[model samples]
Every structure is written in C-alpha cells, then in structure tokens.
Target: MTAPVFVVEGAVPGDGAYVLDGPEGRHAVSVKRLRAGEAVVLTDGLGAWCDGVVTGSEGKDRLLLDVGPARVEDEEQPRITVVQALPKGDRGELAVETMTETGVDAIVPWAASRCITQWRGERGLKALGKWRATAREAGKQSRRVRFPVVADAASTKEVAKLLAAADFAAVLHEDRDAPSGALASAELPTSGEIVLVVGPEGGVSPEELAVFEEAGALPFRLGRSVLRTSTAGTAAVALLLGRTGRWG
Candidate 1:
C-alpha cells in the first residue's frame, strides 16, 4: 500500500533529512503510530511532496525521516472548477470533500438566490473554513499530491463573471423544457479552464439562470435522474476526468 500522507507548511527543500513535527508530527507519532522504518509521504498541499521512511521519534510529538528527493506533480490540464451553490447544513463540506477526491482543481462556493443558507459574518467564515478543511483531508485520503482550493464564497454576479472567463462552462440543470443537453455530449475543453455549476436544493432561480446564460455557461444534465446539490459536482467531475484524460 502507499504510505500514509501528512501535510507540512511549505515546499520540500530538496534531497535530505526532514523533520515531521508540530501538529503533523503528533498525528504521525501518536495517532498514526509511525515508527522508525515505516514509509510515509509528506506534502505542502500545493503539488509539492516527498516520500520518506521514518528514522526516529522525539517524545509523542515529532518524527524524523530519511527522505529522498522532493518532487511536484504538474497541475492537471483543463483545470476544472465547480461553482457549488451552498447546501443546507453540513452537506456543503461533504460536497467539498468528494469533489476534492474526484480531482476538482478549485471550488467556488456560490450564494444562489434559492439557497436557504446564507453566508454572512462570522458564521459564514466558519462554514467556509470547514469546507476548506474537508478538501485538504479528503485530498490526502485520496493520495492526491495536489489539493483542491476552496475559494471565498461568490455572489451571483461574480459567478457570471467566472463563467464568462472559462474556456468551457456548464451548469447542471434538469429543465427538460429549456435548451439543455447531457454532460456527456458537450464538447469538453482539453487545455484551458472548465467550469461547472451546481445549484442549491431549491435550484437556481430563473433570473439567475438568464444571467449565467448571458455569461456563456450552458445548462447541462447528468442523466434522467436528479442528484443533490452536494453530489452533482462529484459525478460531473468523474465524468470530466474520464473524458478529458485526467484519469489517465
């Protein structure tokens, strides 16, 4: 099996001995029970990583490692970003977690018109922190060398601007009457940015849809059945990963 992964604070500093300490060290020594000779990986959560074998431990807080060279994985092509309308309760974090594991490069938390939960002041900031934390944890769990970024929450007008800047933009919608198509049939971008929008439980408001349309984000569906706001982004990402050769 691959070595268990832990996060460090900065880029790897070349082939040498490195100390795995502080909170990460505590997790390694006490929680993971990492001992001398056990293989482990460390990352900065921004593409830089190193693989090493544990060499020793100091108390219950630090672990030493005899690591080889540090290397970085290139950021994936057709950088995928999800514009997720905030879900009610903890589902927002769930959405962030799964999408990170599925290889989403970045996430934009959207405050859509129909969203029941609003991000305002301290509570909003706390919730955003949770989403970012979930992404980091999930990225490590998936053995991803590069973690997804959770951007600050976006307003409807801001979301439209993001859509306008993407090489390809899609919004997950179920309206059979409106002009929409399956995600499988859309011409996915190969090199530039690709943005997909996932609406809230109450769905995207019609007026907001018009704004996104004007910004060039096409409405697309996954299949006949509907998916929750939390899960739709993951499924869409999986499909894009497969089609765009990112999974290769």
Candidate 2:
C-alpha cells in the first residue's frame, strides 16, 4: 500500500532524524492511529518531500520519525492555472479541493459580475482561508509534494491582467454564438502557463467576456452540457491535462 501523506511545516534536508508535532502530528498519532515503525510521507507542500518511518510518539500531537531520501520535484510544464469564479456556499471549497487533486498549479478566485455570493470584510478573509485549507488537505490526500497556490480573490480587471500574462488562456463559456471553437480545438502549449477562466453559476457578463477577450482569453464551450460553477473548473483543468499529456 502507498504510505499515507502528511503536511509538515518543513522537512530536514538529506537523510536524518526528525520530530513531527503540532496539529498534523496529532492527527497522525491519535486520529490516524499511526504507531511506531509505520511508513509515511512528509511534505512541505512546496516540492520538498521525504519518506519516513515512525520511531515513536511523544505525547499528544508528536511523532518521531527517521527520514531519508529527500526529493524536490520541479513544477510541471505548461503549468495549468484556473481562474475560478466564486461559487455559492461550500461549493467554493469543493472547487478548490478537486482542482488541487487534478494537479493545477494555482487557483484564482474570480469575483465575476454575476456571482450570487459576495465576499466582504472578515467574511472574505475567512472564505479565502477556507479555500487555502481545502487545497492543502486535498494536496496531501493526492500525495502531492507541491500543493496548488490559492491566489487572492480577483476582480474582472485583475483576471484580465492574468490572462494577458499567460502563454495561453481560455474562458469556459457555453455561448452558442461564441466565435471561438471548442476548448479541445485550441492548441495546448507544452511550456509556460495556461490559464482557464471559469465563470459563476449565473455566468460571465458581456462586459467581463469582452475584457477577457481583449486580454487574449478565448471563449470555448466544454461540451453540449452545461456544468455548475463548482464542477466547471475541474473539468476544464482535466481536459487541458489530457490534451497536454499530463494524464499519461
């Protein structure tokens, strides 16, 4: 069986002995019921990871492990980034979790014009925190040493800027009159960043589409079916991954 993965604050470089503690350690010891000699994986969630065997537990939330064979994974090519428009309710977290598992390099919470939900003041900060946490947990579950970066919530103007900077960009919209063809038709770049823009449930406004288009974001439909805001980003990312041979 594959060793269970855990997120650690940091891992020792090279082969060495290290102590794991804090909330994650507690979860490993108490919640996961991990005992001494169990094999596990620890990651800093920034491409640094090590395999370890638990030596013992040191009280609550503490586990000692002898770690070795550190590895630093380089970022994947044609790095996929999803500009996900805010979804209502916990669906926002749903988006973050699945996208992370699908191997997206980054996720941007777009505050599109038609979003039913609004994030303001303390609520916005808290929501952003939830997205980050979801990404972190999903990354561990997927055994990823490199977690996706959850960018701050962005306005349409900000998203435009992102599209402009991207090597390739696409807006997932099911517009029958859209001049662009299906997303599969677009040439997937093998290097640099590719950004996929997913709009809200109510859909992207005309003004927003124009802005994205002006910034070089082409509009393309996923398929004949319409998907909810929560599921759209993940599906789009998966499609991109398949096209780029990342799924292979």
Candidate 3:
C-alpha cells in the first residue's frame, strides 16, 4: 500500500526542510508510525507536492521533513463549486466529505427555506472549519495535491449573490420541466468557474428556485428519482468531474 499522505503549508522545492505540525503531525508520527528517513509526500494543496524524507520527530507534537524538488500537476479544469443546502443532522457533513473526495473545487453551505439546520454565530465558523478539515483529510486520502475550500454558511439570497459572480452556474432541481438533464447537457464554460446549487431534504422553495433562475442558474435534473441531500451533491460532483475530464 502507498504511504499515507499529509498536508503542509508553504512547502516548496529547495526549502530543504519543514515541520509537520498540528493534528497532521500527530497522524504522521503517532498514527502512521513513520520513522526517520522514510519517504513521504507533502502538498501545499495548490497543485504542488514534494517528496520528502522525515528527519526525525520533534517531541510528540511535530515531525521534521526534509523537502526536495517540487512536482506540479496540471491545473484543474474550470473550477466546480457546490452550493449544498444544509441537511439535518450529520448529512451535511457527509456531503462535504464525499464532495471533497470527488474533486469539487469548493463547497458552500446553503440555508434554504426547507433547510432544517441553522448556522448561528461561532457555530457557523465551527461547522465550516470542520468541513474544511474533512476536505483536507479526504484530499490527502485521495492523493490530491489541491484541497477543496469550504465556504461560510449563506442564506438563499446570499448564495444567489455568490452564484451571480460565477462564470457558470446551475441549480439541481427535480422539476420535470427543467431545461437540462444532468450537468452534461448544459454547455459548461471552457475556461471559467462553475457553481452547482443543491437543495435540502424538504427541497428548495419556489421562491428560492426563482432567485436562482433569475440569477441565470439553469435548473437541471440528475435523474428521475429524487436523491437525498447527502447523495445528490456527491453524485453531481462525480458527474461534473467526469464531464470535465478530471476523473483520472
């Protein structure tokens, strides 16, 4: 099996050495039991990764890694951002985790009319932080050099503003009259960003749908059956990644 990967900040070729700190450091030393001189890969989560050799442990909290030449992957295709409606309980967390593994470029928590979860004060930040951590872990497991971003929670109106600023946007709806089938039908921008809006358990209200429609977000259907919030975003990401030729 391949050695477990870990993320680090500001890793570069010729930097010679770096420290793996925080929870990631603990995982490398305590969890993986990597010894000095073992080869591992470190990424800055921006398409750059370096094969490094562990020098030694610095106490129980840090691991010293000697950096080497940087290797960069081809730039990802048009960024795909998923604006996921807040699901009840831990379903939203599952969506974030799965989307990360599927190579989504960013995640946005949406508070729609039917959303059962509300982000209040620090709770919102905490939730976003948790999602970001989840994304980071998933990216490492998938051996992705770039980590997907998790955005702060936003209401439907605020999400509309964010979508309007994107180069391409689509809203997933079960409406039979939707103009497109899956994301493949829509003409994706070849060199710009794409944002996908997913609804909650109870589904998007007509008002919220109208806002997205007016914002130029074409409504699309995944299939005939309605999928759970957790499943929908992940399925959508898979399709988008495949269509964009990122499913390598």
Candidate 4:
C-alpha cells in the first residue's frame, strides 16, 4: 500500500527524529494503527514533503518518526481553477473534495444569480471553512503534496474578471447550440491558468453567460448528458488533467 500522508504545520526538519503528535499523531498512531517500523509521509501541503519511518508509537495517541530529507515538488503547469457556483446542502463540500482529489489548482466559490443556496453572514464563513477543510482532508487522502486553495466567495462580476485574465477559460454549459465541442480536444496552454466556470442548479443565467463570454470564456460541454453542478467541475478537471498529460 502507498504510505499514508499527514499534514504538518511550520517547518519539517530536513532529516532527523521528528515528533508526530497532536490530532495528526493520534490519527496515525491510534486511528491508523501505525506501528513502529511502518512507512509514512509528512507534508506541509504546499509542495514540501518528506518520507518517514515510524520508529516508535506512544500509548494510544502519538508516534515518532525517523524523517528523511524533505523535498519540494514543483508546481505543475496548465494550472486549473474551477469557479464553482454554490450548490444546495452539503453538496458544496462534496464538490470541493472530489475536485481537490482530481488535482484542481484552486477553487472559487461563486454566488451566481440563480443559486438557491446563498452564503450570508456567519453561515457563509462556516460554509467556506467546511470547503477548505474538505479540500485539506481529500488532498491528504489523494497523496497530494500541494492542496488546492479555496478562495473567498466571489460574485458574478469578480468571476468574470478572473476569466478575462485566464489564458484559457470555459463555462460548462449544456446548450446544444451554444457549447463549443469537447473540452478534452480544446487547445490548452502548457503554462498559465485555465479557468472553468460551473453554474448553479438553475444553470448559468443568460446574463451571466453573456458576462462570461464578453470576458472571453467560451462555453464547453463535458459530454452528452447534463451533469449536476456539484459533479461538473470534477468531471471537467479529470478531462483537463488527462488532456494536459498530467495523468500520464
């Protein structure tokens, strides 16, 4: 099995005896049952990573590791950002988790005009926190050294500005007459940002689509069937990763 990955705050020693404690340590020692001599990994969740051997485990809540030299992975090219409109219920978190695992570079939560779920006041703050937490956990599970960033909620105008600045941009719309062919075959830049906008359950309002298009974002379709707002970003990202040769 692949060595499990755990997040670390602050600096991780290049190579030495490092204490793996606190909630992470408990998860490794007690929950994961990591025993002495087992292999593990530690990451700062920003590309810096180190392999470790579990040298000793304490009682039921912690462990120590013989950590190796830390190394940083260079950020991959064709950075993908998904502008995901708010979905009702916990599906926002679901979208975040899957998209993080699928290797999205960043996620922008948008409050589209037609969104049924609105993020307001404390509820908005809590929802954003949940999305970030879900991304962190999913990144660990997927063994990603660099976790995706969940930015502050954006408005339609802000989203349009983002698309206008991107090297390549696409809005995942399903209109037969509107969508431009398969996103997989679309020309993509090897470097720079590729932003994909996913609308709400009611889909992108005509006004929203016009704003995006005027910003130079073309409409693209993932497949024949219409997908839910929560799943569209993940599916689009998977295609992009494969097309960009990152999945190779």
Any residue pairs clashing in model 2, and if so which?
none
- Model 4: what TM-score? 0.97
Task: Please list the C-alpha lDDT of all candidates, in the order they appear.
Answer: 0.90, 0.89, 0.82, 0.92
Residue 184 error for model 4, in Å? 2.5
lDDT of 3 by residue, 1-248 (tens): 66567777664554588888898888888888889989888888877888888999977768888888888876687888999988888787789888888888899888888888887889877877788888888889888888888878878888888789889888888763764455767667765788999998887788998999898787888887789989898998898777777775
Q: For all the candidates, what are their Cα RMSDs to the real structure?
A: 1.3, 1.5, 2.4, 1.2
Error of 3 at 69 (Å): 2.2
lDDT of 4 at 223: 81
**TM-score versus the correct structure, for each prediction:** 0.97, 0.96, 0.88, 0.97
Per-residue lDDT tens digits of candidate 2, residues 1-248?
78988887755445878888888889998998898889999888999988999999988889889999888889989899999988899999999999999889999998888998888999999999999999999998998989999999998989999999999998988664654437877887899999999999888888999999999998888887889999988988888899998887
lDDT of 4 by residue, 34-117 (tens): 888899989999999999999998777778899999999998998999999999999999999999999999999999999999
lDDT of 2: 0.89
User: What does candidate 2 score on TM?
Assistant: 0.96
lDDT of 1 at 18: 82
**Candidate 4 runs further than 4 Å off:** 179-181
